[model samples]
Target: MFTIVLISCFALYFINDKEYQQTAWIVLIGTVFTWTLISYWIRLQESELYNRINLRVVNYIKIYILLIGFVIAFYTFLPFSVETKNIVAAIVLGFPILGIPVNLLVVNTIDHLRSSNSNTKYTLVAGVGDMAGTVEKHLLRHNGSHVKLKGFIKCKKEECIVGEDRVVGDLDHINDYLRNNPVDEIVIAIPVKVSKKIQSIITAADYHGVRVKYIPDYRGLFGENYKVTRYGELDAINVRQLPLDETYAFFLKNTFDKVFSAFALLALSPLIVVLAILIKLDSPGPVFYCPIRIGKGGRPFKVFKFRSMRENDASTGGTKSTQKDDPRITKLGRILRKYSLDELPQFMNVLLGDMSVVGPRPHRSFLNQKLQESVDKYMIRHYFKPGITGWAQVNGWRGPTETDEQRKQRTMHDLWYMEKWSLWLDIRIIYKTIFSRKTHKSAY
Candidate 1:
């Protein structure tokens, strides 16, 4: 929808640009290449392997368009007799910059629909022990999550308990069970030595149109090297490592961080002053609170916040995250922290390149050291810049780290956010932070 609208709007703009006809250079390029680009994008969807790469190529095109927009706008102020109209026409094409991701999403949805309709449903072996447990979990976690089982071809003679259902029969009854039920997948959970005996059972299921999935005694369905793949059809999204790390994604992200942070600091200067006054009148403290925090790569930096705690005149202590009923918290501090008004000043941190508008939230040095010692994969989060707000805060993990479980989950969320970082993703997190009431929760 956005694509067609943009193309039409740009075309219309070019047709009307008689005064600045020289600016037609941009419009001419867009009009001539638009259909070609659309064709190539559709071709990418027809194949499975080229889909992701092609989508990224499309992203690069959008980035180029942004650069083109800036250049065209810059040249517009120049004394262009006819060249100005052409430039304006070219700039119009950039209006639908958001269409790139939208189009890819639509294509992915269609692909998922096709993959779901494919024959040969996955089968499972409902048995006893860790192998069985792994197989069952994978089966349940599979895209459809409704794959039919032939029966528990139990390696041991005892019946297995699974979600109030018991194994009614064994490998011997596999034939009989399929005769009476719909079973098209064979997920073998038997040990390798015992697997030889179940080979015929797997063959039987395969002969009967069932796709076989072996539950390895090792670990993970597709290995521990994570790969996050999604099929839009069944809404199945797996947390996995991507083979393609996007340089363009990084470019777009840093560009957005710098651009938006600068713009926000400038645009919100007035609001900052108003909040500064409120803080001064409502309590005794400095307008801005500078807290020591760990930034990207374990570097130390001072994070900016609207002062949300009493400036203790005689108190002496190392860094500490806020907790409920802290004596140093003023009435205004409570309000500011509750609504996250205290975080506004971090835009300066973002501008200074010490933080991102969206990423893992930075921790006080004390909390950072404590968490690093207790949590696995904790330090991995420092690979990316910290943010004013983060995934954990939005997901109800914000407050004080009172419990080990709370801190563990929060750290896990921070790692997850880093692993899944992307420009569109950052934008989504920002949207949630700005609009979601969950972010306003107050806890120690």
Candidate 2:
């Protein structure tokens, strides 16, 4: 499709006038190269691999912007007459806009047909409970054509909530049953309480070389952001994890942080210098305060902030929660804290790899320990790199934790952000931080 569009674009612009042919060819090649690079970068060529329509639309929009931006930049640099550039720009922009709908239609049709005619896999369910029943019903209702439900393996006859007719065998006979029957996949929908039975079924499936998938029962547990992995041949379940934990995601986010921080520090140099001078004149302490704060994985790092209070001997004073009108706050500190200018220095911390642009805000070591004691899952927020501004902060959960409920609510919002972390979500949080009216409402 890309090649066809490129050829069509070239043909449309190619004229019999030889004087302009060279310029036409140059523009055509440049446009095609830029379009191809952007398409590959955004994975538009692999759109068929995804099943979500909304994701496909987003990919198309990204490609559209890239194409238009490339055309604008390419034309701006080319030494061509205004008339020629305008004509070339129109041709280049039209191709991608025209191609998007066609590509969407082709991809959607192919996906529908592929799903409709896909080969059915023979699947068996192990264990019988609410989770098992829910899985069975979902398969029967939504994936009926793509999956064949063989039967269920009951761990205990009395405990089996699924109908007895669907029970083909018990856990004791699972190995023997697989030895005789041909099963493509085994779905282990068992609770953690019955670990021995689940392991037995998994081992049997492994010996038979059949794929095994476990459906965890997360009742009364921190079930969000669960991931399964192997640790030296032993299966391990991760209760709290983030997409940033993956190698690609970590690299992408870290690279963005470094590049953005460098740009911000350079761009805001004038403002930073002026602020530093003002801070020194307004207070008797250093211009910058580097306080030790807990970071990702509970590692301690010095967080950078402009001095916003008077010099004090109490080391714990900085860690102690601040109120709306704390007397310790200096006259100039009020303006800095209200607009979050005090956090500008932390961009340097982001450059140093001690923080991210968007994540759960880091807390002082003393406050972290106290929060951990009061909140059971308080440390879970440390699973990701601390950020200068976070989901909780943007949602008005910043500042002093005056009550147990306030601490829990803040932690809950932070955990939700971790579980739902995405590049888009990060962008949204940053946008809200800058534009939202209530952004500075909770700040002291």
lDDT of each: 0.67, 0.80
Poorest lDDT segment (10 consecutive residues) of candidate 1: 235-244
Error of 2 at 236 (Å): 4.4
lDDT of 1 at 63: 45
Estimate TM-scores for all models. Answer: 0.50, 0.61
Model 2 C-alpha RMSD vs. true structure (Å) is 8.8
**lDDT by residue for model 1 (249-276), tens:** 6677778989989998899899889989
Evaluate model 2: give its lDDT. 0.80
What is the lDDT for 168 in model 2?
95
Which parts of model 1 are misplaced by more than 4 Å? 1-245, 312-314
RMSD of each: 13.1, 8.8
What would the per-residue lDDT of candidate 2 be over residues 1-444, giving only the tens digit for each residue?
464456555665756777566666666666667767887887776654465567667876786777677667767786778766865677656755566577668766665664563555789999777778989987765443557788998876337778889999988899888999878899988766675677778789999999998876764254556677888999877765678778998888888888878998999999999999998899788898777889999999988998898853265566566777888899999999988999999999998889999988998878898999999788988987999888888888887788987899899999888878887888888889888867788888
Pairs that collide in candidate 2 are: none
